[model samples]
Target: MCRWLAYSGTPILLEELLYKPEHSLIDQSMHARLGVGTTNGDGFGVGWYTPDGPAEPTLFRGTGPAWGDDNLRELAHSVRSGLFLAHIRASTGTPVQQTNCHPFRHGRWLWLHNGRIRGFPTLKRTLMLAVDPELFPEIGGSTDSELMFYLALTFGLERDPVGAVERMVGWVEEVGHRYGIDHAMQMTVATSDGQRLWSFRYSSERNSRSLYCSTAVETLRTMYPENPVLQRVTEGTRIVVSEPLGGLVGAWQPIAESSYELVTPGMDVVGRFNPQSAQAGLPVPATVGANGG
Candidate 1:
């Protein structure tokens, strides 16, 4: 229901990615081509990491739309980072407030998701009841995306992100079914710990939202030898987005349904994802079918 991007690699001005591209995040706020919403103008946020600073990433968020926010344009040119996440929101049954913005933070971690849980209103109490009490108070907004983040944390995201996410989704579907709802999940989530980035695309119905990552930097450079932008970046550079920033033929690669990807210092990794198989990774105490006993 929104559009977003996660960047990891060479330190460059945020504007280089958020504003300069033909179909940049800023432009997408006004005219998103591939996302569920054509205009993700409800609100926006940007989170970036600085090597010399704290373990946690710094955040800049506003309740206003990105396209109308002059401050966003100014900050884009001023901040330079090797890793950052930007999101343009199109509210999915949540209030348009600053607290509901993306790139939600929890200590050193940063998470932002694009999609909604079907029938969340009915599933809210059950889902919220599943989160750890300590983690529950930290939830500042009333959005399903934020709740999913906390659910993952409660399920041990810091130690095993993929597994935690799987449990989170599995739990969502589990609750949705108990409430007589089908197709409970739809998400393309990206998260980072200032060191590595993880992204997932999955849904209850198997037709998840659109997501794409850049083709290997070297591969793109070889394919577009004439492109100067492709030439200057280091090999470790990677860009994951809701849609291609431009129409470069070889630049973007689609992520398959029921899959996840990780962008680390070495080569990026992609793997199949199944929420049903995700239970083992979660703590025994938090299994979806486990009783209050």
Candidate 2:
């Protein structure tokens, strides 16, 4: 169990989302209303694309609660980015270390997750052996979240992100079933390649972790014209978080179960996510519901 936020849009200081909101990510670290745990204090990490850096993002991570990290506070106040991701971890039986912190990076891509691969310790070796050998050496942590990233990479993330992630989940579920586990996964994952932001919500049992995307900026502006914050960004700006950053009423929309939201430079897209399970011999579209919007 963990909490994370992904941002894409107008370049602004990191604090605009990380700290300034009423129930910001910092607040979630201590009072997460949706996460399984009230406090996600094992570790935290932030990744962002600088306007003038290499295609890769700059990452600052620590093995401490995001709420108490002084360096995170200073960095959040100082850095500005058009796209970024931040995460606070509540370990699902993993060691607490900086490397295990989220917003994990590989080249220009960054990934983070908020749910565990149920019984990861039992399935770890089987799943790990399936990772692409060339990509295997890049593995740096013992967390299922990081391994999930590599699994997606092994399945082709850079070219087709959605497909890669779908395959990754399918594979995990395939292995879990081999061990007699009924429900193998629960995930609300967000990833970015310094351009578009992609997020997904799915679980084998049809009940996944919580995830929400901001309502379209134009609509929010129409709803709250008096809000100064809404006036600063273009319509392309959007945020995907494990939970709402603030109680803005209409500011957040829950991502449908077994589906994904993609925020690009052009139009944003939401679509059904059917995992291409090897066990099923094809991609299977699990049942999806409104989630009581």
* Per-residue accuracy of model 1 over 231-280 as CA lDDT, tens digit each: 88889999999999999887899999999999998778899987853355
Candidate 1: misplaced stretches above 4 Å? 277-293
Q: TM-score winner among the candidates?
A: 1
lDDT of 2 by residue, 27-95 (tens): 999999998989999999999998798778999999989999898999999999999999999998999
Residue pairs in candidate 2 whose N, alpha carbon or C atoms collide under 3 angstroms: none
The candidate 1 region of ten consecutive residues with least summed lDDT is 284-293
TM, every model: 0.95, 0.94
Deviation of model 1 at 144, angstroms: 0.3
TM-score of 2: 0.94
In candidate 2, position 265 carries an lDDT of: 89
Please estimate how well model 1 matches the true structure, expressed as its whole-model Cα lDDT.
Answer: 0.89
